[model samples]
Target: MEGPIEIRGLTKVYGGGFKAVDDLNFVVPKNAFMGFLGPNGAGKTTSIKIITNMLSATSGEAIINGINVMSDPKMALADVGAVVETPEFYPYLTPMETLLYLGSLRGMTNTEITNRGRDLLDMVKLTEWKDQRVGKFSKGMKQRLAIAQALLPQPSVIILDEPTSGLDPRGMVEVRDILKELRKIDVSVLMSSHLLNEVQEVCTDVTLINRGKMLRSGSVASLLNEVKAHKIEVRVLSPPALEVTNQLRSFPGVKEINYMSDVVFNVDFEGAEAEQAGLLLQLQGMGLKVVSFKESGLALESLYMSLIMESR
Candidate 1:
């Protein structure tokens, strides 16, 4: 099936012959929340620029909803909403006023603007500050407002560039929460980010890239399944006895164990979800009060790092 967003042979070269994007190809499946990931200088931003029509591609096609972006930018991008890099807004305008102005530019009626603007502000948890000047708002608030503006037109596809890049922990959580809410909507999202945990938490699929080249791309579960083993952290209510540790070490799928302390240890576990559940049961059956049993390393992070290393 044709996706909402597709890149075929996309490439970008600067005057210095620096290849920012190199023959990239991928698709943002309909209704899929996909993360575009890579390290610094990995061409993620450049590819997004091309797809959003902010920059022209040297050689390739950026097709949005099946329309060629370079051939008909206005039409291709008509159904798309984008937030690129740090979103900047007029410092003097209130959130409502900013939305109204941008909505007008999109040719929305006053009534449509007011209703949609109010709804979006509420969705992003900015309804209380809807009338406040943007200058007084924190970076997190501004980012939320930016999202409201992007969604003002009710576009079908949303593109975000590191939506949580510069926020503090609280701010990052806020933005991530908004993204989770976004999942409830029917829009297809293609977000570019380097944060592994963020993607693992919110994105259903991921596309990995490096030095302007495609590394791997697929649904999160499929990619994670490629990981042969996971490092799990197991914490018990009390320090485990030697015999308890011995039993744990002998458990099936437990490849290796590294004790962090008497109460906590890391297990190199080669198992599926069912096996993991069994391991937890086994720990409980041993009369140990398990406090936590969770994967210490993100499966996506492991896969992403390994692919990047191989590419280098």
Candidate 2:
């Protein structure tokens, strides 16, 4: 199978010397559900805009299914669909009417339009509201309608920006399931979201960025395991006295120490449990209140923070 998306050194610069993207590179294998993650203003929307041929990039290249997006936008977009930040619709139009309207733009026949609309509304669990005016619908309802329209073209690639926005927990799960169902039919997905938990629940591979620079990009499992350097948090009862941290700081493999709250301290180690034990003993010897200790799992929030801090 051909690669669904290929990007290399994708960069975008605006007026006033502002750069929205900088040397960003990634790929979404054909039929793969790839997550695009980043904090606000991390150039995600800008990158997406360039990919869809909505905006021209200042440099670099991207191809979808063997067609360069910049070289032949029509052919490149023939099999691609996207739902940018906020999906729009005709206020007075029904869900079915909205989808059929979009289908007309794609040159779908009336029969094809009606058939596809019914099938998609059913797929999105909005069959019951197909004839209802979209203006009266809730956010989730509107999103479902937008999805129906987005799929009317039968595109191979579906790029969604913040699919879970305006959705409650159950609605979010529904959208996630919709994406999963798309994967089963070999649809390539490129989704962008800052909701780490949602991405963790749905995406297989990811590219995370901050300040317009790629922080980490790969399988979620590998990225989570990237910080293998062991880190632990400890709580003490008799809090260490002044200058007491200096003694433990001299121990081998102790990278750094941080006091979180008055009684808790975080220790960075180089995977030496023996050295950690020795250090703990030294702290205990100081007659400090040794309360509890636990391993700290690397969280997405922490990973994001580390990326932002490293950028600074």
Candidate 3:
């Protein structure tokens, strides 16, 4: 059997019936690099804890493989490796110590633990600093150490919470690469990130949630395809906003216009890119100042914002 992830009626409630996750449902096919996305306070972390058996869910059920998380927390965790909410480790523990400690908790013998821990450290590029106390490590270095420790159990499923939250550009690349390597080893990954570009970089599929409810779930390509809308950028030499907007409203393909900045506007188009030239010509013919015009690809940030706004 593969590392299929299943969630059924997963719900979580806090004090006074504040539902953290409400009736969420989805499945990440085996070996999937699934992105779990939501804004802050959207219950991403709470849901992850329940799935990993760290916190008992208020109700509902979840399973990885055939392991019932609520009924068999130990066995359910046997093949799951997770770095949740900024990984925690003893400040006195070195990278090596952290992995060894995790290995022991997983019930591996010392020899087996040492061998696997070394390999993981090497894989995460932490071999040189394995003996150094984690307290002395940089943020990126500590994050790498967390990854190494997560792999010590040779888990089939890996979950990372905001894995790139506080990372620099280079640190982000390191964490992304580590995720890619995990796929090579056939480990399924479930990652939560508010960074749209970061999630777009590594996730094949995604499940978006808001206010404790599942909002969307599907392949990235499929999700994008669902949005048939296109956008174009128009830069006028020197034009007035209302006049230009009114003029654009009469164009064949233009649906709406969004002012990007001074002298820049993004025109939403219902037609194709080939029609953009005609639209610009129409502007010029109307005696409106025209400096530059070009087509713009849909931005994930824009897409997410639009979706969320429309939902409300």
Candidate 4:
């Protein structure tokens, strides 16, 4: 079956001969939460604009649900919901009123708007303030409401551009929680974000881009597997003796070990998950009280940086 979103040879150029997007091609598979990752001015937003039919592409196709956006924008976008860049609404309108108004624009009947609007308000945790004016809401609340509005249409595909941008830490977390909820539904999502941690947390698949060119695209697990080595931090109740440390250093796949303190150290491990499990078992068998064992550093962050650097 065709994916919900596909880009083939999509490119965008400005008047001065500068290309903002360059032949980008990828697919947002059915029910997949895909992250569109890139650095600033890397053409992430430009590509999204083309896909959403907000801007004309220099060359290429933006297909949504098997419909070409350029050829039939209204039909192509009928079941598409997008929150592009920062979202703003009339301060005077309440959340319900706002949805009702937007829904009307989308040709929804009054009954349909009220029923879905109420349910969506609850989904976004804005039920208490559904009737409250949007002007008094915080940035986080507004962002949440924006997501609710996008979902009001019961879209088959959801597109978001930096949904958590310009928000505080709590606000970012709230938006991320909403995104997590999105994954539970049947819709396919394409979220454009530069924040690696955010993408890693909420997206199952990722496509990396740099300078408007495609770098790599795959499931998060597959991309992480491309990183042959992993850093793991282990904490024990007490420090190990020098001989025990030496034994640990000699363990298979232990490239290096650095002691951060008496009970905490990091292991540069070179192997897959099974090898990592072996290392953990070896630690427990050493007669040390193991407190915690977890991977250190963002593997995706490392891959993203390397790809971006290489592209440059």
Q: Name every residue pair that clashes in candidate 1.
A: none
What is the TM-score of candidate 3? 0.87
Question: Per the 3 Å backbone cut-off, how many clashing residue pairs does candidate 3 have?
Answer: 0
Candidates' C-alpha lDDT: 0.91, 0.80, 0.81, 0.92
lDDT of 3 at 5: 76
Candidate 2 lDDT for residue 108: 88
Error of 1 at 24 (Å): 0.6
TM-score of 2: 0.79
Q: Mark the regions of model 3 whose C-alpha exceeds 4 Å error after superposition.
A: 1-3, 229-231, 236-244, 252-255, 260-262, 269-298
lDDT of 4 by residue, 85-158 (tens): 87778999999999999898789999999999999899889999998999989888988899999998899999
TM-score, structure 1 vs. true: 0.83
Residue-level lDDT of model 3, residues 174-240, one tens digit each, is 9889887766778788899888887777888888888878888888887876654567788877755
Alpha-carbon RMSD of each model: 3.8, 3.9, 2.9, 3.6
Report the CA-based lDDT of candidate 2 relative to the real structure.
Answer: 0.80
Candidate 2 off by > 4 Å: 229-302
Clashes of each: 0, 3, 0, 0
TM-score, every prediction: 0.83, 0.79, 0.87, 0.82
Question: Model 1 segments beyond 4 Å from truth?
Answer: 232-294
